[model samples]
Structure formats: structure tokens, C-alpha cells
Target: MHEVSIMQDMLQLAEENLRKSGCTEIRRISLRVGLLSGVVPEALSFAFDVLKSGTSAANATLEIESSPSLFSCGACGTESWYESLRFECPECHGILILQKGGTDLELTQMEVSSTD
Candidate 1:
């Protein structure tokens, strides 16, 4: 799946950062996944498990923080959380537009140990 490629890229970035920081072990890789990012968390976790072997992140834990999809009412200027594809505003029954957040897959933080 595409998650494999995504994990590969994440691992590459982690490795690069580890090298730059003189770190030999990665303890955690924290990610922020948006509801509308189109990336499956289960698949991404499986890919990380399968691909981490023998790498700097072999023992790393993948921590995912899910971000809910949010929308703003075009007519009322009200914002709310949404889990479905509904684009109707709850307050004024106006058309809802995506205002902030969601639709993103980002690496937020990493915990690592130096080679020392």
C-alpha cells in the first residue's frame, strides 16, 4: 500500500536526523494524522512494523495523534468538528467550507538516544 512508501520516507527522514544528531537509537516517532489526510493509521502502523527491522527506528514506537476534520459555516462564520462528509453548517444551515487543520500528515516529534 501507499503507507509503505510513506513509512519509508519517514524512516529516511528519521535516519537522517539521527545521523545529524549522532543518535543511535530512536525511542519514538510522533505523527499528526488528519482525518482527511487519506492515510490509514492501521496500514501505516503495519508498514512501520514491517519496515523498521535493522534500522535506526527498529525499536522505535510510532505514536499517532489523530486530528479531526473541521469545517466553517460560510454564512454564519461558525466552526465545528465533523466526522462525516457533510458540508452543511449546523448553526445556520449554510454551506460549510474547510477552514483550518485536517488534510495533513505531519511528523511532529521524535525521541532519540545518542550513541554516547
Candidate 2:
């Protein structure tokens, strides 16, 4: 599954950031996953279970934040929630511009312990 690769990459990046930040141990990884980001938390968690072995984030908790999809009309500049696949704006029949809420896979914060 793609989640496996996603986890592998996320772990690798987390390890680097943790090292850069001088964290000896990580307690949790906070991620902001957009609804349209095309990622499944369950699958990612499963991947993390195996991929985190012997790594800095080993056994670390994964916290996911849900982000909703927002859209703006290009013609009328009207903004609203985009819950459907159809991008047509309800007001002006304009093309919907997907806003920044969804389609993001960002690493928001990390909880780590000092190396001591």
C-alpha cells in the first residue's frame, strides 16, 4: 500500500528533524492531514508500526488532525465548504478553487525528549 511508503518517508523526515532539533527521544508526532490529502490514518498507523522499529520515532504516538475541504469560486470569489466532487460553484456556476484547508500533508509539531 502507498501508506507504507508514506510512513517510511515520514519517519525518515521525522528522524532528520528530530536530530536537527536535538531531540533524543520522540513521544509523539503531530500531523495535519487534509481530507483531500488522499491518506488513510489507519493505513498509515499500520505502516508506522513496522517502519518505526529501531528508529527515533519508535513506538511513538501519531496524532492526526482533520482538515476540511474549502473552495472558492474563481468568478465570484465566493467561499464555502467543498464536500462534493463536483467543483461547480453553487452560486455563480464558476470554477471552484480548492482552498488551502485540504490537500495538505504537513508536519505541524513534534513532542520530543531532550537527549540529556
Question: Highest lDDT among the candidates is held by which one?
Answer: 1
**Poorest 10 consecutive residues of model 2 by lDDT?**
80-89
Model 2 shows how many backbone clashes?
Answer: 0
lDDT per residue, candidate 2, 24-99, as tens digits? Answer: 8888988877778789878888888888889888858998876678888999999887544448888989998887
lDDT at residue 79 of model 2 (Cα atoms): 88
Off by over 4 Å in 1: 81-95
How many clashes (backbone N, Cα, C below 3 Å) per candidate? 0, 0
Give each model a TM-score.
Answer: 0.81, 0.72
Cα deviation at 34, candidate 1, in Å, is 1.8
Question: Over the stretch 51-115, how does candidate 1's per-residue lDDT look in tens digits?
Answer: 99999898999998887777888899888887556688878899999866778798889999966
